[model samples]
Target chain A: MTDVVVAGGGLIGLAVAWRAARRGLTVTVVDEAPGRGASEAAAGMLAPVTEAGYREESLLRLGLASLERWPAFAAELEAAGGLPVGLRTVGTLVVGFDDDDMRQLEALHDFQQELGLSAARLLPRAARRREPSLTSRIRGGLLVAGDHSVDGRAVHAALLAAAEAAGVTLVRDRVEGVVVDGGRATGLRLRSGGTVPAGSVVVALGAHSAGLPGLPPVPVRPVKGQILRMAGAAGLLDGTVRALVRGRHVYLVPYGEDRLIIGATTEDRGFDPTVTAGGVHDLLHDAIEVVPGVSELELAETLARWRPGTPDNAPLLGPTAVPGLVLATGHHRNGVLLTPVTADAIADLLATGELPDRAAPFTVDRFEAP
Target chain B: MTDVVVAGGGLIGLAVAWRAARRGLTVTVVDEAPGRGASEAAAGMLAPVTEAGYREESLLRLGLASLERWPAFAAELEAAGGLPVGLRTVGTLVVGFDDDDMRQLEALHDFQQELGLSAARLLPRAARRREPSLTSRIRGGLLVAGDHSVDGRAVHAALLAAAEAAGVTLVRDRVEGVVVDGGRATGLRLRSGGTVPAGSVVVALGAHSAGLPGLPPVPVRPVKGQILRMAGAAGLLDGTVRALVRGRHVYLVPYGEDRLIIGATTEDRGFDPTVTAGGVHDLLHDAIEVVPGVSELELAETLARWRPGTPDNAPLLGPTAVPGLVLATGHHRNGVLLTPVTADAIADLLATGELPDRAAPFTVDRFEAP
Candidate 1:
């Protein structure tokens, strides 16, 4: 029997499987579709503060800790995968356009300060002068120094390679249901009618977690988001700028040579991922307000997807009511943000059979009513 | 003097200039990087109702008219450019998961019926039986017969070829400002300090119009989005499936034999166009949920871009307050959808200096405070 049978092979699941295998545990990840879940559709922004304000302080603390651990985590993955994950320490600058934005920025700053977090700093004209591409119509800006970013695709690739190197078996099969004898989780039944027994089962099914049978009811839901991708002229944008410009949320992120990442509209309108004209219009209008030069860039692609959001918007982690079944799903917006921490936490849990403090607050029982 | 000097050579600007030039009017288009912008990133989803909302009736109507004119437009463009824009009339199927989704589907169905439009139909079990690969979990679907799609990149390329063939001078110049003399539009001053004179200037700048100074204040905003381009296992998804499966908005647009377009997220985080971990995670999650077989496909590209949007969520077309400047900005998401109409409308206005009825509703006056 394997030490752990990861039910999904997305970034979260694969990372856990890889870390557990590194610790000399036999790991097998059963996923009919690997690397094709929320991991593939994410922008890979590692901003704990930028993504904060979801009313889950424990999850926020865990995310902040993961951000702290990201450098080492990325280095290890690079060493294992033999490729740079484009891990850039370039800070994210959140700028404001008018007075109302200033008020919002101040509130966010106050919240970060209350957390004893040095993640954000207000930037004046002198700081903005460092970046010449910034428009003249600037009020003030917030610099989220601790928040960093990485190439999410590179991480996914690295995890796959690292997991394979660590001797984790990645079986491609649709997990129809979990094999449970009495109250303990035993294994997974594949859609192909095959069965594989396991010492433990980690339910990391992302948005599809609630649908999987043999597990206690998990409250995972899908939140639809649409995005657009464009290729800019080389050296178009200098650093990451998250702007509250022209009364709209806009961000300009530059990557290697001529690629700029732009995005996303959040809608609860169940999984109808058609590229709408309205979604596109909203994106372009806000983008141009911040960076007029984008008008000159070539549009590379337009896309849409669904984020796996939990009721609380925080991921469910660690142990479940079942003895051998652990829950590792419901990482709504922060699956990419919490990847390293999740991997390490799950690996630690599998080794010790005890939940870590970092993942303690994200228990599946949070959604259960007394 | 030329009727108009378009400040960009993208599909939006060029199509407008081309239509005007075809109508026995002299036109010049100034573009630093022509045939780019969101036009290059777009998959050319000509879907109006597929992208419609209860409030977006006007935009939907405009999209429907363009969809009706698309076949003839492509044919005309092909005739002029000796190149084909891959325009397919294969209707889109918006798939649903369960009873709750059927309610949303019914609402959209009701909306379609109320419009007296026959382009959409409700697909039941009998119709869905034709496609066996679709999961049994699907309760029902909406068939948008009028909503079609095109290869947006191909259309952009074809437009360039067509524009060149139609005797329009495509000059490579970064327009600095419009040369206004005596409160009348004269020409454009280039970044290179050169000047080109014309009778009028049309700002069809897509997401970049907000930066061009000395223009009527048009509230253009940017909405960022991300997408993934995958190579399916030779005919994985037949035609386009605009899926509303389980509240995850996803589109499985099939491009030719193996390429499938899946996407995106709407982010108002300013022009940071980096493809994030979250974006990838969400896209793959929904893609797998909608079409369980997509996991086996090879991921070709993970891309992101920003779309141009307006306040009212509709495009700003027709005349501006500036005498020599005709405002054709703020098509936002429908830039691709309104390409034909915009081109035709702008060309008509340029030749006769009269606003066509089709372009009247989209006038800049709509945004002016009463």
Candidate 2:
């Protein structure tokens, strides 16, 4: 029997399985579409606070912790996979246009200060000074120093490579059910009428985690987002900037040599993920507002995607009610941010049969109604 | 005399021209590579709230206004081009897991309500009951009803058809510079040494607007975004659901027939629009968290593109400081959402030689102070 049977082959699952295999545990990851979930479509922004607003502190903490581990984790993955994961600690600048936006920034700054985290700093002209591409609409800004970013898709590829390199079996099959014997997960039943036994099972499904049977019910949901991309002169902006210009949330992220990353729109209307004229129009309009020079760049592509979300907006990690079933799903926006932490935590849990304190808050049991 | 000479053939430029032409004004459009740009790469979602929050009220207002006009605009385009623009007003839902996440939902609801908008609603358990696929772990949700969506690529095709049908001259050549007669814009100088004379000019170059010279400086900057597309079980999701999930900012948009739209990451490193391994991995991970059944889907495509950005994160619209040179660049993130408004506003401005109230806040004058 395999030491671990990962039900999904997403970044989280593969990272865990790869880490487990490195610890001399036999691991098998079962997924029909190995790299076609939310993990593949994500923007890979490793910002914990930029994504946090009201009370997603737990998730923010987890993301921050994972962000702390990203450098080392990415290095390890690179060593195993012989690839660069595009990990960078360039920091993020949250800029505002007017008084109301500055108020919002101040509130966020106060919250960050209260966390005893040196993640954000207020900027006046310093924001535009650091990145000259910024227009002189001249307003206040918040610089999140601790937060960094990575290429989510690259990390996914590296994880898959690392997992295979570490001798974890990657099987392509849809998991239909979990094989439970006496309230313990023994294996996973495949849709093709096949079963693979394991000493432990972990469900690392992203948005689709709810469809899997025989688990504590997960409140995972699908959130659709659309993004636009363009190609221009490289080195347009120095670091990631979340523009609070005119009370509109827009971002300009540069990723090596004439490419800029801008996105996205959130929508909830079932599963109609089609690129729309209105979506494209909005992206261009706002992008132009932030960097006016973008009007001259060549647009490379536009995309729409879905992100898997949990009830608390925190990932479901560590042990479940089932004895041998460990849950590692529900990492919505921070999947890339939490990748390193997830791999390390799941590996530690599988190795010692217990979760660390950092992962305790993200336990699947948190979803229980009680 | 033509009031504007739009210097691009993509959806944004064409839409502006189509609207301008409809306003009983002579308009000429020059394009090097028409029908490309973020318009080609976008998965259109007309969700202002879904794309809201970076404190982008101007863009949100613009998106809402355009969304209000989308149905009629799409119908007009259809009437002109004899093709459907794939416009649909399917609302969006932003869901949360627990009390902490509920805070974000509440904040969004409050903000929407404060905006005097009827598009958003706070959904309880009963609201989620309509879709059984939604996990029981949902704490609550916020639904944005007025937000709609469409297929951008389809609209691009239809816009070309409509533009040609609207008597707008479509020129195929790279724009070298603006032809200025007596310090007033007259036409475009092609890269092949051909000059196309016009009464005026509109620099609707999308991300590439900065590359052109002898026009108003748009200050357009390119932002890159990467995305992945997958084909899942047909009719997998009921509508679009976005989650401020786990500090990762993820969403799942279903585009009919088992195909789900998954995406994207924001990076500012410059113009290498190649699909990376990490992007695919992160997208898959997040997607599975919301819909566990997607492991059974197939990955159809992976894409990367750039978006144009401006200084204040708002688009530059209306007339420029240069005589006879109207500016319509710097539309970074809200290009798609602002298509209708942009088109109508440009048309009105061209016909009446006066800027509309909606275009006042997004003027190029805001960037002139520096």
Candidate 3:
């Protein structure tokens, strides 16, 4: 029997398994196809400061904690996996195109200032000076120097490699249900009709984590997002550019030398991964509105994926009602941003069977009836 | 020695070879990859009436002649190839978005009327009645009942099958130059260092027919065009929609049940085939402006190709200056629409050693300094 069994082999599950294995615990991850799902489409923006909201201060703190661990985490993973995760610290520019967009940006800037976040307000000219590819039509923007990005797909690949190097066994199969014996989660029952008993089980199936037959109730829903990947954008922008065109949100994140990820449209439709024409047009339209030079790049690909969303938009992590069962899913749009902290916290619990104090507030019990 | 060696395998060359084979003349076609180049991107708009220009009366006559032969040609080819060529007899609508566009359409309509073409002028509402998917912002339009369309790719595939079925040898090799001997065109020198000896050599390489070694000067320049292919537009438009959006021209041609071709931009950029962001943006912006519903269709593909353009924009379709050398290229934007007439005319010349009367006016000598 394995010491721990992870139900998904995405970035979260792989990272948790790797960390658990490093703590002298045997680990096995089961997934039909690992490193896919939302991890495949994440833009990898670690912009805790820019993404901070008014009432979601706790989520903001969690994002900052993960952001703080990214540098060391990336270095250690690169050394172990022998792969570069394309982490760039050039920061992000959040621009607004019209008067209404500027007003919203101004309000966000005030909130960031109230929270003592490190963001600088910039005029249209100043914003364009930082990223010359930006359109002259932008009204204003905010530059958060602490905000950064990485290539999410690269990170997932590196995590898989690092986890394998750390002696974590990877089972390429689907988890049909939690193998619960005596009201305690024991292992995973795979779609291939095989079972691997474990001392503990971690559910990390992203949007598919909800309503497993033998598991406690988990509140996760699929929030569909349509994104476009473009190429030939080398030196177009120094960093990421998130914009509000009128009232709609759009972002362009430069991944490698000439590849830019333009995204996305948030729809509540469940698990329908159809990349619609309106979604692409809206993304391209707003991207061109913010960065005019994007109109000259090659549209490399278009994809739609589900971000595992919860009611409060914060990830559900740590211990659950069922003994020997853990929850480390529901990262929503911040899955890539929170991968490091979620992995360490969940792995700590899996090894010692105690939820870390910092991660205790994010347990499933927080969402249960008061 | 073979009777004929055609130096391209695109729609024009394939059709001509098939027709010649049907006339009991042995033929061989040389192309590294058959039915590609501009043939792959042609929108297959058979709109001689609507495409009629003021100074292009001769070209208009040629297009009308080809359009007249398309029905019989498609039927015979489909019968021989055993494949449906997706020929739609639904007429074409040339619409206008603004006053300038409307005035341009009106002038073109006047020219068509003067040429005795079958076109009916329609008001905005009447035009919408014809194609309900057209945006209400259309100022006016002209409906040409005689114009029609076909699936260019489907036609090429069918032509390939028909040509092979007619005992035409398809040499999947590139033609390096015309094999000239004793001041007479004999055959073709292939890129594979092989020589194909023939009684006659037909230079049908489209834009690449201009300056081949050992061949007479054929004034064909590559006119770059970028186009878009979309899907999920099964019933978006009843027929083709050719629109003048502001001062720009955009056409939407529906082929199979759900595929729509949106095209294109005319650039004199020499043989560059990079599908730029500006090119796709312009096509999509104008397409959406003309038919708002196009914003909902999937952008299936984006491609750029070069059209063999001539000074008069009319194809050179007869024997050239070199002995035993025939010119059957330079169809420009009308390649697919002109395939039937060009094939019949060129095949007649090859089989009888005399240029057909209709194709005689389009010889390379027409552009002589005399």
lDDT of each residue in B1-370, candidate 3, tens digit only: 8999999999999999999999999999999999788999999988888888778888888999999999999999999998889888989999998889988988988888787888999999999998998889989999999999999999999999999999999999999999889989999999999999999999889999988999888999999999989989988988999999999999999999899999999999898878876787788888998989988787888899999999989999998778999999999999999999999999999999888888888999988898
TM-score of chain A, cand. 2: 0.93
Ranked by TM-score, the better of candidates 2 and 3 is 3
C-alpha lDDT of candidate 3 relative to the true structure: 0.91
CA deviation > 4 Å runs, candidate 3: A211-213
The candidate 1 chain A region of ten consecutive residues with least summed lDDT is: A273-282
Task: Assess each model's interface with DockQ, reporting 2 decimals per model.
Answer: 0.03, 0.02, 0.53
Candidate 2 lDDT, B33-90, residue by residue in tens: 7866777666677788766665778877887788888888889899998887777566
Estimate the TM-score of every prediction: 0.54, 0.53, 0.96
- Looking at model 3, the pairs that clash are none
- For residue B138, model 1's alpha carbon misses the true position, in angstroms, by 40
Ranking by TM-score: 3, 1, 2
lDDT of 1 by residue, A248-333 (tens): 77666666666777767777877665665445555666666666666656666667777778877888898888888988888887
Model 2 agreement with the true structure over A248-340: per-residue lDDT tens digits: 677777665566777666666446566553445456566666666665565566677677777677888888788889888878667888888
Better of 1 and 3 by lDDT: 3
Model 2 bad stretches (over 4 Å): A119-124, B1-370
DockQ order, best first, reads 3, 1, 2
Cα error, candidate 3, residue B124 (Å): 2.1
Candidates arranged by lDDT, highest first: 3, 1, 2
Off by over 4 Å in 1: A119-124, B1-370
User: What TM-score does prediction 3 earn?
Assistant: 0.96
- Writing each residue's lDDT as its tens digit, candidate 1 over B1-370 gives 6667998888888888778878877888999998667776676677888787788888888878877788899899989888778776777788787777777878888888888766455455743654445666677887877777787777887888888888888889898888888888789889999878898888877777876767767788878778777764465655577777677677877766567788667777667767654565567667776777775565567677777788877888888888878877777667777889888887888888898887788888887789
